[model samples]
Target: MPSPFILSGCSGGGKSSVLDELKDRGFTVVPEAGRRVVADALQTNSNALPWIDPLAFCRACCDLHMQDLAKLPNQERRVFLDRSLIDLFAYLEMKRISVPADLGAALRAVSYAKTVFLTPPWQQIFVNDQERKASFKEAALEYEHLLSSYRSLGYQVTLLPKTSVADRTDMLLNELDQMDA
Candidate 1:
């Protein structure tokens, strides 16, 4: 399968908002795995939550992300992934946890566009939701980790300008159009 374009950054930095806008415009987008794992855990009253069992939570995200990728059409579909398996790997590294063997193999099995659109941390737009409980400070730290990790993995980081969602969406589309050319 062809690689996807990923939107990733700090947890609450509006990656989802941009993806929402793209979806509104009828573009194909993959949901973030972390949020889905958290929501599922909460619904099932499972202890695989980040606060309770972080390693398990990370593994769950990896599994879900892989599943999400599996559902993609095996072609250059121009799919935009909201975060990715690498983001789960970044989270593991940030927490100083060792990556499981299956996780490494899974990472090797897939690829994404070399350029990743990263939303910078903006305290003004950050909010504390039930799924995302990280404080702004913590989220900023996570952003640093994601930036470092993506660079280490040879992905070019494109920081999304801090602006209204509409502007961000337009900028992203322009980039995608260039990539298409």
Candidate 2:
């Protein structure tokens, strides 16, 4: 299986923008699961929302992420993921929710690349949408949790520079090229 390259950080931290840039550059990209879950919940008028039913929301996200991971082509050397299973753990931590044992097991079974691209909290670009309702302060706290989660999992967290999407894409491509060399 090809290990995924995860782009993780707080909400509205330009992860989606960076993912878009990678996709435009011809790389396979996996969209974030949380947004999809929220959209589905909203459409169905279900209580599977982060604020309303966080546990259910998280479970749905995990299921979707697993499906996405299963669909990835094994022959692909590198794929960019907007977020990974580890992010769920961070969310649980941030919400003071207990980590489900099964979820923990699932997270332990999967593996990602050692170097993860992390975008720090950037106030200039941070914005709350209907789906992403976390306050800027909450986003910052989430960023910190994400950093700790990745580190605890023993992955090298590479902080993406706070720059334009084009520049970030260039930086990522350069880093990948160097690693390939």
Candidate 3:
């Protein structure tokens, strides 16, 4: 079976960039579904979801992740996940949004990569692009929340080095290579 590798962290943590690099190296990369969904909703209708409800948005996000997980091909050597379902909890906690009982339980069952790669907050490389909706400080809190959630679930999380994007990509690839050896 092909092991899925999840790249998760705060906004502007270079998760997407690293995923692109891995994709270029012949790895199957699943882009962040939340971003894609939001962009599409915005483009399709000006006020498609103007009044954002955290619970509603999170439900959609979870569904998107489940879809991605189901579509994975076992023959692929590696699958790179841009974000995992656990992200929804981070968003909920950050926004102080109440998590419904169903959503909370469902999220716990959503399995991500065994070795989740986390990118620490790197201010030098963190730029607020159009797609990046969270500020540096907000992202910091969200990152912490994410770490806590994963730890609480007993998932072993690995922190990616705070270095050049290329170097980080190489480091993860090397780690995966060792695992495959």
Best by lDDT: 2
Q: Give me the runs in candidate 1 sitting further than 4 Å from their true place.
A: 74-77
lDDT of 3 by residue, 47-159 (tens): 32314656666776777777888888876587889878777777787777777887777766656567788888878778875446778998888899989877876777888
The stretch of ten residues in a row with the least summed lDDT in candidate 2 is 69-78
Question: How many clashes does the backbone of model 3 have?
Answer: 0
Candidate 2 regions with alpha-carbon error over 4 angstroms:
none
Better of 2 and 3 by TM-score: 2
How displaced is residue 96 in candidate 1, in Å? 1.2
Candidate 2 colliding pairs, count: 0
* Winner on lDDT (1 vs 3): 1
- At residue 129, candidate 1 shows an lDDT of 88
Per model, state how many residue pairs clash. Answer: 0, 0, 0
Using TM-score as the measure, which candidate wins? Answer: 2
Off by over 4 Å in 3: 46-51
